[model samples]
Target chain A: MTTRSPLRIEPTTPPDESPPMRPSDPLPALPPPKPDPATVPDPVISARSLCVWYGSSMALKNVDIDIPRHKITALIGPSGCGKSTLLRCFNRMNDLIPGARMEGTIKFEGIELADPSIDAVALRRRVGMVFQKPNPFPKSIYQNVAWGARINGYKGDMDELVEKSLRRAALWEEVRGKLHKSGLDLSGGQQQRLCIARTLAVEPEIILMDEPCSALDPIATAKVEDLMDELKEDYTIVIVTHNMQQARRTSDMTACLMLDEAAVQGGHRTGVIAEFSPTEKLFTNPSDPRTEAYITGRIG
Target chain B: MNLPVPSGSVERPRWPAPSRFRRYQGPVMLSLLAICALVTVLTTIGIVAVLGLETIHFFRESHVSLPAFVFGTEVDPPKFGIFPLIWGTVMVAAGASLIALPIGLLSALYLSEYAPRRVRAVLKPALELLAGIPTIVYGFLALVLVTPLLKACFEPLGLKVDSYNALSACVVVGVMIIPMVSSLSEDVLSAVPRSLREAAYGLGATKFEVSTRIVLPAGLSGVAASFILAISRAVGETMAVVLAAGRMPNVTANPLRSVETMTAYIVAITGGDASYGTPKYLSLFAVGMTLFVMTLGLNILSGLILRRFREVYN
Candidate 1:
């Protein structure tokens, strides 16, 4: 493993130019009636009373969360806590699961995400996803980066776009000379980054990563974490992870989900958000006893 | 750490020593299984030896030369030609492929990608049952029904349709192999990881694009292998071709004309009253050897296609 510094020193954007805020950033939305002061001034995705079920068993129950624009928000929890489910709900990826049902509203950029008339395909184009497993298509590296854009009717200099996407994912420096090699030939870390580049090629506004480094080694994990830090400058990111250290290292906001022990019904445990706050505050001064217990390893 | 220390007071569990019968069980079972495996290997060797010896004897006969047998155009008196038989087999195999490949592939795509769970459970086995129907029955059906149907459809358009023709044989043979192609291809397509589908769907690709562009291309090696295997099955198909396609070994491309495939020729000559040591009797082994080589080559080609192009999934 190449032990490069985890902290990236150079900025891809010009030094004179800061991260651009959208015109919609000025308004502090007031729909929830009782807004948490810790919540961001603007949110890219807001899920209200989101409940998800897989067939007869419930997975998530009345969980509310907000993912702010151009910020990295980490969802951390133990197994079956539904952190991954919540992240999937942002892009409606749960729709792919058979018998998966969801109730409640997921508003993506002021539009109802669950509306039947809202094309999921079009929604996915605006909000791309990176899976827990690196799933590079069985094609050349160039094709892996270019295919999504090609199918989505991208009309531009494809070679330039591939280069830009790869560069943005911090993978071009290693793969620039072998652009035509199979994407599967890359190492696990590179494959995951390649997946990130594939997601970026579509120019999505938000990127949902589901434990993007769980299958990677620690060194590779740090590389992906570094890539995530760089990516949050241009794209809103919501990542589901079990590694609490990773959440603190890479995210400004963190939401921890826990099994609702008191709400256990018919032998099934529902998942609810135990705490959602700034990463530093949640780790240091947790208000909820359950959150403190979980943070201190007394319970999960 | 205040861990419990062993006091050496508790008795350890003990297992009994193996009995005399138990000691011999391993070698006994090993030899039993080894013998069963050796049976199949010996059977294949036996077949090859028989075919080789007879083919060599046929070639050594006074009037029969290896080149003349393979490349000559006559089959009577002095000349022994196998080209016409090979041509007929090729024609049937190619024509059958034209029918089976697209239909089989589409059926596989539908089964793997579009069919509901309940529908697939019932449909998959039912589709495989098509392969269970005896080939003799297919031959009879082709001779009595398919030939008449084609004649009725095409004779009106002033096209000559032979009572026993390669067209009907091709149709029946093609239908016979649809299950083989569809079943094999569907297994391959289904083996494509769900993560890849999710990846495509995540990129806003429609289900159609996911199936055709991603899943199909990912399993291209297996799909190509299935096609070759099906074509080989069609090449070696005997009863249906013998009954539907007449025993006339003519080198022609016309589907409406009568033709005899290699398998059909072997069947015809073997059933006829030719003397045991005559060239005619020995010709059966020669034709049998050709058919064996053809199918062997195709099977090896299929295996090669699978190994050479298979996508490794981690």
Candidate 2:
């Protein structure tokens, strides 16, 4: 419950420069080493040694990180870099794909999510997701928002929940007047906001968004970014984005991934983490050369 | 000075002359359009003219009472009427569709939603084989095998079953038309955008829920059209009904009782020796026209429903 902002003022290195520690600029110390399990506070989700493979090809390699509670963390990377793959692993969405396999552990609220005994349906109820494209069922706006709650056996004041969720998504004012209208009738940006509202109605602890604003215009993207900032007060948010500026604007922490060489047998692309740090530090003074090059637009 | 400058201004480049081949394009295109229009009009006129003239001649020559023809007429000698045949046709078609709809839709659901890609590839072609088998073969199988099996099943229940009855014909027709329903239903179900299913899955819906709630509703129009087409085929079916549905024109509700269908009656009178101008012979065209009108009506109704309810996801 502590908001500790320990500014780790590290020396900024150029993209092509060597890793030299400067005496004047004190390198920011990493967070205190994680406490033992007996004393450790629970993280919303902790992915340890997470690796994913499709058939013979590896998509994610040895990624270990903890997503803190009630904060927005953004994963920024180039295309085919496995950020989406890692986000999908949180809810086992990869299971739908043929030949997809995973190794290592994903613990959600201290429970091993990849365990065979885990019920995926209940797991998804606690961790809802919003895709890049706005896909509302060819149904009324009310029905679209009510779907997740109804499916999860929600037995509350549905009308209140719907209004509150839409308000939380910053979409109620525009859409409340047309609750009975088709979801598809809304503009793309409004539709996406409606999707966020739908996801919120389920009362999930964590909300995973995969480039939620990539398809939107600048104004729409800014609106969603603002919405994310407000939502972080109550919900843990994990988002993947190709836009580096979006990562800087909306995230408390940033993790940058880059594609490694393909596997010989299957030609499967593997992704490796280049840098993971506080957003301000990562964007202003990156530790890794690849991250510096990527943020500055010198290389993809 | 301005006018003189315009007159001596640079002359535009002359356009190239057309090739000889380009000259015939207009006539050729017009001729093609005329041929298409002529073919369409001729087909429509030909069908209407044949059905209309034959129906008129049938009514003029036939001495059968019109009321009895429409709604079962009982005479001293049990004179011919179309009401019993119409009843048999409707009964068989409706019963067959009832049996076929669930099985066909389930199989289609499995193909579209459950089966793996490789398995679906193999299963789809295998199911299509049912459509390729001739209708006469189904008629033979219904007569030779289905009739006996029904007798054994019904006799124990104290039901008086005829060898050729509506039950056998309907069951055989259901089996024969399974591919039509399944194939069309599969296409429609597959046409549903994958995004919809993914949306449902993201909402924590089970596969069964996604299929039933989203896929089925999205494809309802196509499924309805398939049912109507299958039923029309069942109604107009001649060889199978003639062989499996008995020739006796009994207006009974019991499916196990012997009955005659309109198509079966037409086959009966036409197959036997009869003078062309006689009342008995004119009865065939009347029955044919009635069957044609009924099937056409069903097709039109199905088209209307499809236009009304078909989902446009784009």
lDDT of 1 by residue, B1-314 (tens): 89885665367535568888899999999999999999999999999999999999988874677787777777553577988888889999988899999999999999999998799899989989999999999999999999999999999999999988999999999999999889999999999999999999999999999999999989888888889889989999999999999888888878998998889888877787577889888888988898889889988877887776666565
For residues B1-314, could you state the per-residue lDDT of candidate 2 as single tens digits?
Answer: 45544542457534557877798899999999999999989998897778778777866665556676677544112355678888889989988888888888999999999999999999999999999988889899989999999999989999988988999999999988888899999999999988787777777877888899888988888889788888888888878877888787888889998788888877767788466767677777777878888989998988887776655566
**Model 2 clash tally, residue pairs:** 0
Alpha-carbon TM-score of each model against the true structure: 0.89, 0.85
Candidate 2 C-alpha error for residue A129, in Å: 1.2
**Residues A196-273, candidate 2, lDDT per residue (tens digit)?**
998899888899999999889999999999999999898999999998888988888888887653231234467767
- Ten consecutive residues with minimal summed lDDT in candidate 1 chain B? B7-16
Docking class for model 1 is medium
The model with the greatest DockQ is 1
